[model samples]
Target: MVRAENLIVKAKCFIPIPPNPKNILSLKSTITSLMVDKGFEPENPTISGPTAGDAGVYYTFTACTTDPEGDNVRYQFDWGDGSVTTGWYASGTEVSLSHSWSSSGGYVVRVRARDVYGAWSGWSGLVVVIGEACPYVYAWNGSAYVLDNNVLVESEVSNGSDVEDFYKLEQAMAPYYAGDHFSVYSIMLGEFENEHSFIDMVRLYAVDHDSSVKIALTPDGQILTYSNPNPPVSAVDNYGYDWLSSLSEIDEIYYQGFPGDYLLLDFGSLDVSQAAKLVLRANLEWKKETCIHVQTLNETGEWEDAAILRTRNRWSTIIVDLADYLPNPEGTVKIRLYMTGVHKIDFVGLDTTVEQEYTITEATLFYAEHSESGKVTLKLLKSDDKYAELLPGEQIRLYFILPNKPADKNRSFIIQIEGHYYAIQ
Candidate 1:
């Protein structure tokens, strides 16, 4: 009994042995030490990728860190650019983030991680967010027409006789006259008549040819009629007084004709006293079996040598520059048109039925250049004779007289020139 009581008292008195110092400080110090060991080699580091400059494009980065003792880890990411968010993911081995750079240049990202022991891993490598370059584009607006520089002289349509109806006359004569507008048409009689009767009537109509007359045929081919809407009745009937009266439905005839078809263009009236250029717009028609000759008429009414134009079908505009054709700088010049083949003709006015003739007195040589094949230059000796406004690629004829040859045949030494005028710098 004495020993049990005494033992308890002695145990209490003896181990006033100070209780072991609390381990709280040691535990805290341990955690702090582990955290200090968790620092990344490149503290607060980041890795980035390439992007386009000034354009909002994607940038990727990685956060790297390590713990001294292989421990369960968690990561926190800060793009460092300007976004703010913090979190821990279940599969938390590495921390990754994405961001876009607004401008062109290098940028830095920051990342940090912690271990389950409250040990913070240092930052990762400093990643550079690189920017890419961009390019520029230009734009414009308008319309333009282009023609090939190659020339085809006196060329015939490949299939002129096969599809003559659909072939265009202008296209067939393109080698001779390539212009913007042209005229073409056809004429038919109700019934075939004697050549004498037809030729007589045609000559009569030629007297006051200035007047426009309508010619038509009955569907049954029994009657032909002619009418002059703006008639001095005498002018219309003068040729065949009883010719029209014998026909049926004379009033229904319409005079829809082309100017180029029946009449020769008389450019002689054009005033070139102050013009720099003269442009003639004419319409022409062609048929597969016939040929049309274009010639100039002198004051004496004599026709010059003609330029034969042939076609299978279609209408085309024929342009003639009168600069070289005029006998004098200020006088009347005439153009003669003759049909030798089976082709027909017609004429139409621009904007109106009344034809207009423009006079040019002052002309400008828009362009004048030559190649080395022995240059033939036409210098402007008189500004008053200006007929030079012709565009590049226009056509012309150069009349040269060879020595010791008859004047008539010598003049035949005509050289056709294609339009390829160049402007002098």
Candidate 2:
């Protein structure tokens, strides 16, 4: 019986067979296709901001690429500052990385991608400049005036409108940085009664050629921060003199009163190293005394009248001739405005001209081919009169955003101007 059972089991068993040739070929073909060393080249990467910046700043770069075999990928970056990032990430998705240069220079940022199969794509690159940032901010030599006279007053101002009030106020600035232009200001004279009503005369001190420039914005710093809140408000708040508070009591500041009262305004300190000109403004319909006194602190600390305004009221914009007073290339100086001789204290405006930033859109630059093997000649393109209007010693920090190439620190570039020779610092 056991022998019979064994024979039956053997009958049921059969030999195992090999796989079919077509099936084996199909499997092999799939494996071979995956092994192929192919990866899609990454699209050109992009930077977050302008291609130029100051050192110690970080820049973000992004990239997106695909793989022919749909394999996961990793990115490698050469940040041009001896720094690199070799990190793996998903393919066909956007990836961003940030890097900062340690020193000021021109750098080539290069990037490439690799797949899980170890196939690498070609490199993409960008050039960035790391150095000084250009500024074209408002540069002015003007100061505003609002009076609060409660006591007797003594000023370099010649005539007194009314002598009973002590005054306090602020000096603001206004200036245009273009070709030499003129501005006007006026005071409303009642029936032409006070024929000599004028704004103050402002004189600028000379600036040093190598001194730093001072920047004054619209309503730079007013005196209200150190004084009272709930300041006097009148019916004529729209004529310009208006201060509400700066959020929590830091808003604007203005002045008001009939003729015979005066206000003294202090404009703090300003660096006038590159002052070009000045102007003052006011809004008036009628005037009694009609005078604005502008004075500057001399090197000896004595206040001297630098400008006076004589006008017929309406809307006035007056030029403060700084030809003799400016080019003050030294330290900061103080300015003051004495306002009197009007029924309502509306607003006063001051404008001063200072060195401005070099702009390619507003101006242009010209360069000559490499003079020798490594040197080039540069000049301001003054055909449009934008750069030609700039005076000597007008400092500008330039930024160059272009493809980075090998540069030698020993090589120097020359900048030529029509009226003066410049020494590179």
CA lDDT, every prediction?
Answer: 0.29, 0.36
Off by over 4 Å in 1: 1-262, 273-290, 298-301, 327-330, 344-425
Q: Which candidate achieves the best lDDT against the true structure?
A: 2
**Candidate 2 local lDDT, 50-140, one digit each (tens):** 3556667787887667766566777777777665655667667777887787765446677777776555777776545455211111112
User: Residue 353: error of model 2 in Å?
Assistant: 45
For residues 198-243, could you state the per-residue lDDT of candidate 1 as single tens digits? 0001000000111132211111111111222111111122122222
lDDT of 1 at 190: 13
